[model samples]
Target: MFKLFLLTSLLFLLPIFHCYSLPEPCSGTCVNAHDPSIVIRPNGTYFRFSTGGKIAIHTAPDLRGPWTYKGAALPNGSKINLKGNQDLWAPDVSLVDNLYHLFYSVSTFGSQASAIGLARSPSMDAGTWTDLGAAGISSDATKRYNAIDPNLIYVNGTYHMSFGSFWDGIFQVEMNSPPTTAKSNVQPTQIVHNSAESAMEGPALFRYGEYYYLFFSKGQCCGLDRSRPAAGKEYRIMVCRSGVSTGGFVDKSGRACTNGGGTVVLESHGWVYGPGGQGVFQDPVHGPVVYYHYVDTRVGYADGQKRFGWNKLDFTTGWPAV
Candidate 1:
């Protein structure tokens, strides 16, 4: 009948209309979450590690709900004694050998006087993490790389940390077993570099099927006051993929990522502004999920006012969809 046809037509059109509206996050306080990284406990508790306030810890029973702000992971701060030791950034956490190992960044903004440090906890409970000093990688002002935004990835029976910011783009280095430190005598290799040679950081590497998806942020990341960057120059989630862990990453367009080519995974749309600093995890309920910090234009754009956002990734098309 005409009535039945009208109902079906509206149903198909709804997704096109609502696709830009991101799902709301957390039932309680999800504010102050910048550079968000998610780790789920075996018992289904979600722990959020983010940059700021000594790597602040927030937890929830489920990803959607009644989140509670737990205390700092390191109340006393990092043991590395760097300039930004008290205010950690870009925490990448993973559970290995029954212990939760966290790799965090210690650096001041715009300076390569930065170091990545390691810490671990038997349980991801707040105040339980013990700093294990630097993870054996650093960069000074004279270096080509800024050495921040650390993401821990395991591939082919070895561990590698992908990190970089501003100056050069993204790089990866091998780590020995236990992965407490970077392997000595091994030089870091450049994995993904934008051709423009600027403003790419926060690499979260993951293996989905045959390719290693290199998800990173591109363009201006902070200070979106008054005016924003011109269109694609604002902070957006970009991705490249490689068959192997080390290099040869290309975008969906078959363009080399190192040649300033990357597929935009998510960008400013509707109320969601400058969504980057992303991390991914395979969730039991949601499957593959990408979590990030986004400036909700409705809320304001200060770093502290940033919000945690997540979406289940659809890889049906051989590339991730938010």
Candidate 2:
């Protein structure tokens, strides 16, 4: 026939031109599975929020997902009066003007008194959750900064939040409503100030073209010490960019995240150690993807513990670098 129907229509348009073209690097199941937060709902469905603190809703009428698991929108196991000791850590979701706001984090391990919490789900649809309590707080360890990883950005209408970890880096605040009730003197600024080698935490924000990306992840995460793979520098997953979301923020060899810059994006080739707690979304059609958590080192723990390992992210030049 006409040259086998033009080689089967160029092999189905060559995977739609390799799914929207980018710098490329993520080769198969995109890390197979870890911390991936790709949300695309307006009636399209594709939600992913992680850290085991809960929030994983994957529904796909499209966006190429055989994906269909709509469970755990976070009401799970419950316990949060504060003093730090609840399981849910690092869960981020954002949607204002139409409701659905879920930002989570509450800690107690190497404590900086961590706390960042809020929940609501009018339309990510599954259970229609609601738990608006303690949207921000970092308990005062003399107060430099260390309020777990929470990310939400609205821009002109104001939602702005970028949390912290390790007591002295990555902070930003602004929220009046959309579920969050109070906090808007405009005061929590310090964009990025990590060092010591690398101890920065996860903070993700995005806005391409004019540039406003601020994806974060830094060294030393979880470890079981099955010898040495997941125990050294904490973790990896670095990236910096800023036309101005409140930063000079450069990396991708440009350097200058205050003085650290960070550019690796995603590390650990074989065993998968500290991949870092990260977040980035867009799945209306698989547009931009990144979700984090890693340390599968081999997966041992019963006290043999080496918890949390999840993945998916790839950007490469505009520089998500993972």
Q: What is the C-alpha lDDT of each candidate?
A: 0.87, 0.63
TM-score of candidate 2 relative to the true fold? 0.30
lDDT of 1: 0.87
Which sections of candidate 1 miss by over 4 Å? 1-21
| Candidate 2 ranges with C-alpha deviation above 4 Å | 1-36, 39-47, 50-58, 61-89, 92-104, 107-112, 115-147, 150-167, 170-201, 204-214, 217-238, 241-253, 258-322
Candidate 1 residue pairs in clash (backbone atoms < 3 Å): 195-260
Best by TM-score: 1
How many angstroms is residue 114 displaced in model 1 relative to the true structure, after the best TM-score fit?
Answer: 0.4
Expressed as tens digits, the lDDT of each residue in 1-322 for candidate 1 is 9999999989987845325448546677788888988888988898988988888998888888678889899888888977999988999999989999989999987788999999999999987899998999999977778778988887778998889997877888999899999998898888777766488999999898998999999987887865678876889898999999888999999998778878988888888889999998888887888888888888798888988888889899999988
Candidate 2 C-alpha lDDT tens digits along 253-283 = 8777767677666666555555667666654
State in Å the error of residue 241, model 1. 0.6
Which RMSD does model 2 reach against the true structure? 20.0
